[model samples]
Target chain A: MRSSFVSFTLNGEEKELLIAPGQRLVDVLREQCGAMGTRNGCGQGGCGACTVHVDAVPMLSCLVLAELAEGCDILTIEGAARDRTLHALQEAFVAEAATQCGFCTAGMIMAAKALLDRDPAPQREAVVEALSGNVCRCTGYEPIIAAVLAAAAMLARLPAAAA
Target chain B: MTRLRGRGISAVNYPTGMNLGGDPSQALIHATTTGNFVVTLSSVDLGQGLRTIMTQIAAEVLGVPPESVIIDTADTDTGPHCMGTFASRATHRIGNAIIMAATEARNALLDVAGEELEVAAADLETDGDGRIAVKGVPGKSISVLDAALAAHFKYGRTISGRGIYLKPRSYPDFETGAMDPDSCQAHACTIAEVEVDTETGEVRVLKLTSAYEIGRALNPMMVEQQIVGGSWMGMSHALYETTEPYYPDRAHGPVDFAEYLMPGPADIPQYDAVILERPSASGPFGAKGIGEMTANSPIPAIANAIFDACGVRIDELPITPEKLLRALDAAAVAPRR
Candidate 1:
């Protein structure tokens, strides 16, 4: 295979890495970028455990080729926190006991993050629809929905500056 | 024709540990110079929060806050031998061992503190705030940290303990067919409601209401997660999951998540769970092993509901549409298209 060079902003940090031709973005992010928090659950697009924010959009890194990420801004689970405090979604997940096994948590949080960013006050069905791609084999998705709603309320309660 | 609705219930008794040559688990506890307790175990967590629960058990026994106790399930080299994690026996077996070990560690801590305070070991009790105080005399107390320091440097004694729990293998009385094979048994019942389409042979589960009599829910939240997830697995096994649709052909096995069948978000049914706790005789703080049984009852419950809906029984896993249509035709319940 051919070698390719790519540069992207990851978690607000500028990153430049070498990649092989046709390599998956997920593989490059995990292997080269050392973004181990972005788990590779299925390696295919079916399982959304490798979800990452590309240009502020939730995209399945497993399906996207590494070359496609050139000059793109990527955000991973590691970026979900500010300073030492956890993101509101992370706090809600812990409070609601939504991250049981934690395998699907990063991707689940990323998906929820995207939804919360798009619609800060999502309804219950809307939260379910947003998280449809993310599969949590634990908690039966009940606590997950509750966590998203709880996060939404928390965001709503926060002042304009902190949010 | 409109869809037919039916409800069915299933009850099952599940045993705790697999008593294979006396199932056993061991735990070790030691205190650092700063009085932070460390618990070592070879049994893995597998994301089930075993370390967290074990830490809570140890802290309770040692009379320290959970944050002051750390659980180390990391290398087997430093941990004690275990029978591995299976049969839902980690909490029940390993927990009991930790209780014993922590009790001993607590004794050692109290003894060291008693020596430092010039009081009897039995007269001192942990105050749950990093201090050991004499019974009924809260003013005269010594910080566990200082006692631990004294034990290491002054007394030259290691404040540590080891523990193990075993439910020995029992043989049946062949004449009467009586045997005590398990330490304890937990019970579960699930009620499933489903809707079946006569035209398309499609079955959709509407809701699952379940009740569990797990000896004790050490963490109710964790128990709820296990129950709901296990029931989903049961539903998947009852209707969707199949590794070999065309068995013996071997050409069409699933290669990845795309080919494999599982219930996705849209496919989930409403899950309701109720937990009842009856402390066990030999459990660690009245907690029993209840990880696997939550998946078992839902399978039979779903199968029975489908039968009640269309007067057909599909014992085979998946209860695929093809088999359902065939069974419906044989029963003359198939609506004429």
Candidate 2:
């Protein structure tokens, strides 16, 4: 397999790295970037544990090749939190106890964050639909759904705080 | 008291109460078990709310906040040997041990606090936040932290507690398969109404109503969420979900996400959760395990619901549209008077 140099913005930091032809985007993020938050539950993209945002859209990192991520801004669970402060979704997840094993938390948080970012005021059905892809074996969908709604409410009040 | 939704009857029973005695009780107060506060448990939290439930148990016993109670998972070196997380025993068995340990720790703390504050242990109370106060002496009181610190310095040791609980010796007979394998068993009833397209043979779950008998709900919101999520996974297992064969000659089944046909955003139905919090005498705070119980009911419930709607009974799982159509055809061709 031929190796290629790939350049991408990871967690808001720009970086260039060498990758093999068969190296998946998930491997690059975990191995090269040292982002262990992007878990690989199922390598075939069946589970959404390895989901990440590529150019502002949620994409399965396991399916994307390292070469394909070239020049794209990739946002992962590490990026979701700034400094030490957690994202609203991550905070809600902890408060609501939405995370159990926490294996799927990063992916679930990312998926829900993507939905909430696009539409801050999503209906319960829409929230469920948005999180339908991410599978959480624990907490069921209730805490997760509640966390998303709560996160949305928190985000909605952020402007008020700023004012 | 908060009323439980759906089937509210307490059907599942444990012969012995949750307090499997470690030592003799003193003055009718719950005997605080010693050397068992920080128990090493074997159960794995496969996303179930075992940790929270265990925390609740410890908090209730120690008279502290759930947040203040720290539970470390079973690791080989630091923690005591425990059954690795599986079979929903974490919250039941391990939780009981935590409660016992915390109770002992609380007793020891109260003993020291009683001396420092010049009050009877019974006269003192620990608040939800673990703040200790005399019954009427508002100004004179100490916190659990203070008590623990005092106990540590005075006794020349840490005030932390530890516990280890083993499964009962007289448990269900494994050879006959008659014994209940679980420390506690959960019962659930799910009503899954689906809409199946006769033309394409695609079955869509329209609405799912799930009622589970979880001994007691330490957290009602978390319980409801577990049921709803499990219901979706169950629906996927029954209808759309399939694992492909590893080898090519094995004849490919649902190998990937596309072929597996798991319920996607378009697939999930409306969910109505009914959490039955019938406190099991043996559970910590009467809470039975709901982790795997909710998953067991949806497949049968959906199949039964489909039969109720279309007058067809499909015993096999994942009752695909193709299977339904075939069943429909076979029924149509059967001789009729």
> What's each prediction's TM-score?
0.96, 0.79
Candidate RMSDs in order: 2.3, 6.9
**Which candidate's DockQ is highest?**
1
Q: After superposition, how far is residue B217 of candidate 1 from its true place, in Å?
A: 1.3
Could you give candidate 1's per-residue lDDT for residues B84-104 as a string of tens digits?
888988999999999999989
> Model 1, chain B: what is the TM-score?
0.95
Q: After superposing candidate 2 on the true structure, give the runs of residues whose Cα lies further than 4 Å from its correct spot.
A: A1-7, A16-22, A67-71, A83-85, A91-100, A112-163, B1-40, B76-78, B118-122, B158-167, B171-185, B243-249, B255-259, B335-337
- Give candidate 1 regions above 4 Å deviation: A1-4, B246-249, B333-337
User: Per-residue lDDT of B1-337 in model 2, one digit per residue for the tens?
Assistant: 1111111111222222222322111101121122223433444455566666666677788787766655556554555555555455556667666766667667777788898898888888877676789978767888766676666666554545555555544444667846433456677677777665655656677777877777788888677767777778888777865463235664656545544566665566777888766687777788776666666677777776666555666887767777778886777788333
Q: Please, what are the lDDT tens digits per residue for candidate 2 over residues A66-152?
A: 998889999999989777888889889988877777888888888888898799999988998888878765554667788999999
Docking class of 2: acceptable
